[model samples]
Target: MMKKIIFALLVLVATSASAQNGITNDFRFGQGEDSLRCIETITIVNVNLNNKDYATAYTAWKTIFNEFPVARVDTYTNGVKLLNELIKKESDPAKKSEYVKELMNVYDQQIKYLDKLQEITKSKLSAGNILGKKALSYIQYYNNAPVDTIYSMLAKSVEMEKGQSEYAVTERFMKYSALKYKQDKSHGEQIIEDYLNASIYIVEVLDKYHASIERSEKKYQEEGNPRDSLNAIGYGKMIDASRISKSNIDAYFINSGAASCEDLSKIYAPTLEANKDNIEYLNKVLSVMSMLKCTNEDTYLTAAEYALAIEPTAKAAMGCGYRYYKKGEIDRALEFFDQAIELETSITTKAELCYKVGLIHFSLNNYGKARAYANKALGFNNKYGQPHILIAQCYGAANKWSEDDVMNACTYYLCLDRLDRAKAVDPSSKREADKLIAIYSKHTPKVEDLFMRGYEAGRSVKIGGWINETTKIR
Candidate 1:
């Protein structure tokens, strides 16, 4: 009977596999062939360890581990690193500790080779296949975390791995097989819907901790400033206040100024511990970024690094970028902005940041760079009035008059009219309004030419004649 049940289970599994071939085969569930082999070896190592085949397991593991000499390169080898860690912590009284020590020595021996490989691949974060940027993030996260936190974080890393792999497969299919998929509207729509759903999930997860604008407002009242850079406890208190103020853990903490990234992380880490789910996605993003810090140039890159360590997201990256920009570190600013824009999906937010970068470039007199940023800002969101005005200014400076400049001029005047109307309706603006009109009237050539120009133009003889005539009329 047991044999019959096992046969039935195998039949069911085969049937399910066959059925999946027809449910729109756009996504690959697990690792590809090459990576699968590595996963299998790691699985064997784990299973052997469980079976008390420690000697045999060590042999399989050593061969497997040696294959990925750069222990930090990808997830599989990183898992081997974790296995090494587990071996070290094994507390069986009868166990030979030297065996674990030997395993670690093997890992150490491979370290220089890994470091050399890291140098070659450091500039390239994402590939089109399985080991993309997000996978790298998982590897880095697992490498850095404490043991307890590492276990807790594994579930997130798994989710990210699935999402990233599925996304890669879907992207490849769309690029390579769009015609085949396009014929089926239902399948196409389902693919789009699923992608959108994943994007929304990630965005909401990031925004969940975006924090309240009101938190700054409250801090300004409580401490008479936005933050205190001097006292570490003050920063920690600010993070606590932000979390406790909201019943749901939706707002993220941001610590700006002289505080290093680690300081910010330490201060807000308590909040992260209190609200784990919202922070999980960010953790993965931050982890991968920390490993790539050798490329960063800003003084606060370490602080930015810390934020990614605490909670990885485009928001934290943007915060770091704005700081770098303020410090006149243009290249570093651009680096963070590039990362932020690629990760961010919000048009409004992206447009706002683009405008800011444009303004920064404009301030630096990098007109060409400024124009590029301004164009990108407009492309992202055309409705923003300030970007239109900025582009108009850019064109005016270049002595190139285009249709966009004229349109922007009209927009500027229309905006001013609306603002003036609003001010006119308010009692407080009445005095200011009169003062503005007095100044506005002087510069308004049309109004001045119509009323004052002709009067001034033909007045001399008439003025003397009017003075004699006025005396007689009175």
Candidate 2:
């Protein structure tokens, strides 16, 4: 036992001396008593941090921060928490700024030590992820930092991460781009393109995030454990911040006036053919062009043609509908319109699709199908009054229901009934409805003629021969 104690002491003395000489230089923990103290203090700092002892944690955390920059990456991670606490508790603006600046430096140092982290702990850290977090922290703490500085960092981070972007960075990149645009309208051209990329990526990432939450919930259900579910909630909250950011960027882009058809065509048309086989590229062009109401542009037509030839997206289908409709292929256009409407999820958009198809049939003098499509539009969105106007127009333009002029004039009741409904559901349609009412009411049959026809003026009448709607005799 005496020999074993002496051997152990020798090993300890050798270890302390080797550590003093910087055995590997992977980290900056000190030598002898200081090295041991740093280790113990770090462990205790984490314990205090975990137990909500921020004050104690901060005091010990600074020692690791200042002397052990090369220590474990957790040193920097914990430093962030400590610095954040200091910044929050600080009453003096100068002191708060100092802490915030130190926090930013901690991120930089974390990046610096990332390559050395494999020696101590497993770390798959990427510069992209760290820079993204740094940029977000800068935004949060630095008030309005230089747009150019934020933009440069955010752009690199997003380009590096691609689809797996830190969501806030992707969102704020577009947002700051908007601010830059306001400062210099010349920035609008690039911002329009930036909005396209950022919006698509953010949407894709959000879908993945939602899918993760769903999987987590499913796993928790099977296991009867809430741990994964709780983690999912935390993850979802982080992504949810991007949701508001997404909305802000969307509003900014829409109102930027940079999405005019000519400008959109210039941006997208030059590359449409080369990207013809690129389904994702085709869809991007179709989506952005359609969003900016560039349907009349040749870029939209070529993109839709390319995308529809490859794989039909919702916007691609809608664009093809326009293509065929303008080519006088009404049947083909309606087919694509029906496909787009089915693929779309929004009720208002579906209504708009149906009404548009109804107008096409009306233009072709197909009143029966026109009214049919119009009624379908109203079914989708009952508050939509334009379809009602379309149906009224169909009734006014239809052939005589009877050889007797009086009986024929009674069709006016059907037309007027649709007009009234249009005015009732949508007050914005009142002017158009009143104008049609004046034209149709002039053709109304006298009460005596209705009485002679065995139809009371106040009773219900079913119009026959294509216009089969129920209406009261006026």
Candidate 3:
């Protein structure tokens, strides 16, 4: 036992001397001595950490973290693990919190030292990344911390990192924002701003990942099926993360009830007058209002008009079109819808614009124009079920323009045909298509009417007027 104690003490002295030497040479950047010392200390720290010897690792880790903080990124990462283990073993809550605070300080030191080291080593350790790790630490270990304090850290981290933020940080940031809103109604605008900022950043990240996936897919095809060069797995994880973040954030907003039209009106009305001329602010407000389906509110019109006056993009044009359409002004709505469709370049967006225009024409009782516009939408997106349903409704309403009972009943056949097309092309609309098919089947030309019109059940007949579709008499 005496020999074992002496051996352990000798090992401890050797380790301490080595780490002290590393601390002394930490300031000598680009020197062989400094590099050797850093490597030596790092190896020792990592070995202890890897072996789950947190007590031993913590001593060496602190030396490297404080002395050669920027020498290796692993110092901070490994320090986190070591501190977490120490905190977990502590029975006292206060001591655990102190360890958590030390962990946070380690992250802060990383940001400070990494920035300096980047100038020397050309490393890519960003301040935003360090800040993100700090925020995550607070969330993971300091859950009992003050909400405002945690929220501020998360908000700053998100602002600094933007689209490069960690998925977990974004999620926690929104949760705190919601909590803050519930605790104090006065912070409603801040909550909205936080949500919008997080949403925009999430969308940007998703767009980047989608673009990467596209490039990867193209590379995979060009590589002739070996498939090893494909970054599909990497990009796929990013895509899934973005999607889940979006869905979770959206659900949080909806369940919070803070984004409802009534809430938004109360929140945004005062700010609107002040920011009416602030084009960027107006656009953001209009976007959020539109996303929350508050287009019918007066605030939406105000914001839309402000945004349009500054810049007439597809978004503003669509807002104006929907506003007028809701007011029963079909001509004005059609004009704006056309402008929106012309201004938009995305195929999916164009399809939606065309569908909106078709709906307006249909509402105006212009069956021919509605059918034409609906077909235009299909040309852009062949699988667009809404346009197909709109066209069917137009055909069903065409009976109002028919004079004879036989012709009126025949319009239902045309309507049913379009409904069938909808089901065939878009499986998402299958249930609705089947329900409409059952209802419209009863309206098909009666046997007596068909016979009177000199039409047999299997005989093909030309439907005149606006609808030029041919259908077999049923």
Candidate 4:
């Protein structure tokens, strides 16, 4: 473990000094009591290192100590101390490299720690905050927010903020409060009250930082990059420190985790509504939302409608529409199903649509339309029981009862045998043996003569039915 740590330090130093010699000694930048500025500077330096821009690296390092005296900020003091050590040990190129690595490792650690502290401060002053565990996880991954988790974390923060003002003043709690403020400005004061001083200071810092980020972000926007879509979503309009903090929840969602479609909607909804230009992103999210089934009926309809606008043939949209139809929302259901049928080319899907349309017509008491639809459904899937049933109803409704109807019903019964040949299954069908007997019983003398004739015929043919008919003793 010790060697691994040392090696990591060495790598940073080597990378920092590889392009030029004695660059470490010239490095010095500090923030005098401006922790936010100090962190931002370090982030900029790190960015320079990432791009391998040695000139920027050298300039940024010199600016750190020269720009701000180390006496004012502990973070700057430690940063300077680490950098100075690298300079003094600059005799050995290899050793200097190790020092560079150590410097980078320390810088990264400080940035992460500061970020956490800032978040805590923001949460403490606010109406709510996430758990320390989750915040740590987010910092570790640098990924998007886990949307489902935000709800739990926010609820927990609100509960914590209410219990003790001191607890609320903590950095984590302050971050939570800021987030809540963004979600609903009306509740900002309640949460922001917990850490008044930190809240005030961080607000100013965030303003400077937010502006810098925005300016830099604008360049990316000019290129028509699709990724800028998230930032373009109305995060800019929210300026209150509290709202800014709370809205970071949306940032966390988009940046930190793999979220479902519904999750994306909740996060982007506010921003998308505020900025009409973000409609593209909103539509994208809505597309996914349409595919997702929610327990809430209203949400399903809303998502389905929006999704159909993007993808007319989406199965989820059709399903939602069908549900609406089942629940008596005929117009809405028809709209969805019609789109699905128009867009889908699969025979099975077409059959399903036909069946649904027929059923809908039947429910509306449109017998002629119902018959037409049922016939169309059967034209594609003659063996499907529901369509067969629909056809039967259509005939019965038309008062067109005939022997053919009975035979058709019998064909449906035969279809059941194909479903499971081993187990004889009937969909509430009554035994027809007695009915057959009654029909035969009506033709007494004719039946008797027929029986006698059948016996004569069977005697010559040696058939089973002739013997059965010839048994007149009964």
Candidate 5:
């Protein structure tokens, strides 16, 4: 017995000396009895955890956790898993609540050693990641947490991580932000702020991960690996899942309905002076405002011109176009507008810019050019009702269809046909289309006039000029 006891003491002394020298692994298990105790306890507890023996794991877990708190990140991670299982399984409310609090402490203790763990090991852990997990834990187990509590945690995490933020956390942050807006209309500006920030990074992360998969597939294909097709298909499914999670945030933003063009102009105006020099912030501001169709606002024009001075963007050009257009500089305005169209890539945005330029031409009473630009816009987006509306208006404004009085009267019929087509392709245009239909329906040729002109109800007649159209002369 004496020999065995002395051998144990020597082992403790050696182990303690080794720990003091600095360790590359085994985390913060420390020296002497503490190190041995943690090693043994964690081993036994992890076995129990893996075996679904929570009761045994719980008994041993606390002793090591209290004694050697920083033993490893895995210690805390496993603690959370079993605690969650316990909480989920527990029928008794009071016991379950106590377990939840203990689980909270595990996260807290992990944070205390966060930096130290990274210093000692190759842990890629970050403060933002830690806080994000805690926030998710609150959502999972402590769900009654106040809105501000969850919102604040998520904000810190998102700001810290940016494009590094996990899609799950970003998605949750936007969801809670929408809730915040729903509960109080006063939160609209804040919601818009969060929306812009979160959206920028969410897309970035999606692209990054997508690029990773592509690179991997390309490498495998170049190696002529038989698993190449299977690997790409499998990885593609993962990216698709991420896409769904990231996209939910945008859907939530729309549901919030917080930031419109006019509202954004008001919200961002005061901050422009401070943010003018911040190129990234200014670009984001310009992009957000442009997306909201706030391009016509004075505040938007200012941001556009300011951003242009720092870096020329499509939004900036578009904004400058509106400014010149507002000042009645038609030639300069069209130049900037064309620049905007050429710089933009999205089909929808290009379609909108074309429509805007078409509207500009219509304002100048250049009916043929207006129709030409309107047709250009439709070529970009066939289902775009606004361009169809513009074309119909162009025909009506021209008010000339060959010098025949009967043909001129028949113009209303063709105009009504375009209006009907507009509403058919896009339901959102139905109200405006109906209004035009109501106004022009009264101008159709009377039955006596049609009879005298020898034009049957179902007879198709082609109207020529800038308004070249064929329709039945009903």
Candidate 6:
């Protein structure tokens, strides 16, 4: 046991002496005749690091870090690990802050020396990735770090990588901007700009991931088997990241209070006028304005006009429709709603547009036109319950009935049928449909009233005029 202890002490002394000599000589590989000494120090540092002996690792690590900062990529990579361990083990706040600063420096050095090291060692480390690591570390460890400083680091990282930016980095960029906006309202424009950039990048990443997933699914279906495990795992991770990023961004915007109609108009009004000819900018402004429900504002109208003139889209048409609808220009509103339905390819969106037209007709008391529009909505989406209720309302209106008891009472039967259909088709409208059904069932022709009309229960009757629907006597 004494021999073993003596041997261990001797090895330790030799390692310490070797590290000291390397530091004294400023040994660096490819620098001079001390190449072997640099290699020996690197091995010693790596062995200690691998064994979780960060303290011992730091002895040789510091020598290489100071004397040969550009010796190898691992010189910085392993240095990060060593310093982080030091930070964790440190009990003093000042010392921990120093260690944290050193860790950040290590990342910066890695980026500075990355290209040269890549030339020498063929490493794949990118400047963006290094910036991302530094930014993430600052966010996690340095609570007192300047928000702008951290945001700048993340912004540069995102700019460098764009669609390839890390999900966490993009998410953090938005969150930090939101935090800054809350702290200082003067930074509102900057916050909006950051959110736009982050949203664009996130959407691009999501599109790529969704396309990849679709391709994978297609291949799997064609082959009647699963994709390779690595591809499957990669797609799963990307999809999960996209979902999380989307949710985070959505929630951040919804809760940010900066996206309110008044705030959005204030932020986008000037931007819209300055970039009137920039179609892409106009589209972005329109999207944000519409999302914040600022469609009633002049900024929204200006954006909609510019965007529609540049290139009409379903959304642009819908904006115009709402503008006209608000002005009580029923014909113009219907025209734009029709355009929106034609431009829209999504069945659900088309259904909604048709339903809006139906609402306009219902408000005008044009029962025939309203029913036609409602039927058109149902054709697009048969499960749309609101249209069914609208049609029932059109039939149940006082104008649809007359003073003649039998004819007036018969309208209720048709109204009840429409309401029942609504309840059956749309679970969301069940309660409303039930209430309307109860109110209208009492208005249905009583057995005695049907008898007075020379009719009996279960006899077919055609109630003509606006409501031309045929129903059986109750």
Please give the CA lDDT of all the candidate structures. Answer: 0.42, 0.77, 0.75, 0.44, 0.78, 0.75
Which stretch of 10 consecutive residues in model 6 shows the poorest summed lDDT? Answer: 19-28
lDDT of 5 by residue, 1-474 (tens): 645644554454336544531234453665665556556777788789989999899889887777666656677878888899899999999999999899878878778777666764675888887788888988887767888889889989999999788888888899989988898888887888888777777766656655565666787878878577677666555555555665587789877788777778777898998999877877777778765567778888888888888877777898899889889898999999899888876555677789889998998999788888888887765556788888888888887756777678788888898899888655557889999999888888887888887888899978887687798976
Q: Write the per-residue lDDT of candidate 2 for residues 277-340, one digit (tens) a residue.
A: 9998888787677656677677888788888888766678999988887788878988898899
- Candidate order (lDDT): 5, 2, 6, 3, 4, 1
User: Candidate 2, TM-score vs. the true structure?
Assistant: 0.62
Candidate 6 TM-score to native: 0.58
lDDT of each residue in 1-474, candidate 6, tens digit only: 644643443443333324333223333252323444556677789889989998899999987887676666788879888998898899999989888888988888777666566765754778997898899999889788888898789889988988778788889888877877787878777776777777767766755665565567677767756544456557656656665675587567667776677778877787787887888888777666665557788888878777788788877787888788788887897898789889976565577678878888888887788889899988866656789999889888843456686677788877877888886666657888999998988888678767776988778878777677787776
Q: Give the poorly placed runs of model 1, Cα more than 4 Å off.
A: 1-303, 307-313, 392-474
**TM-score per candidate, in order?**
0.27, 0.62, 0.64, 0.25, 0.61, 0.58
lDDT of 1 by residue, 61-120 (tens): 665555534322442344445445556567773453554445445444434343344444
Candidate 6 ranges with C-alpha deviation above 4 Å: 1-28, 92-94, 120-124, 211-227, 269-275, 290-298, 312-474
Q: What are the clashing pairs of model 5?
A: none
The candidate that wins on lDDT is: 5
* Over 4 Å off, model 2: 1-14, 19-34, 50-56, 118-123, 228-242, 269-284, 307-318, 325-474
Q: Highest TM-score: give the candidate number.
A: 3
CA-only RMSD, every prediction: 25.7, 11.4, 9.6, 23.1, 11.2, 12.1
Error of 6 at 317 (Å): 6.3
What is the C-alpha local distance difference test score of candidate 2? 0.77
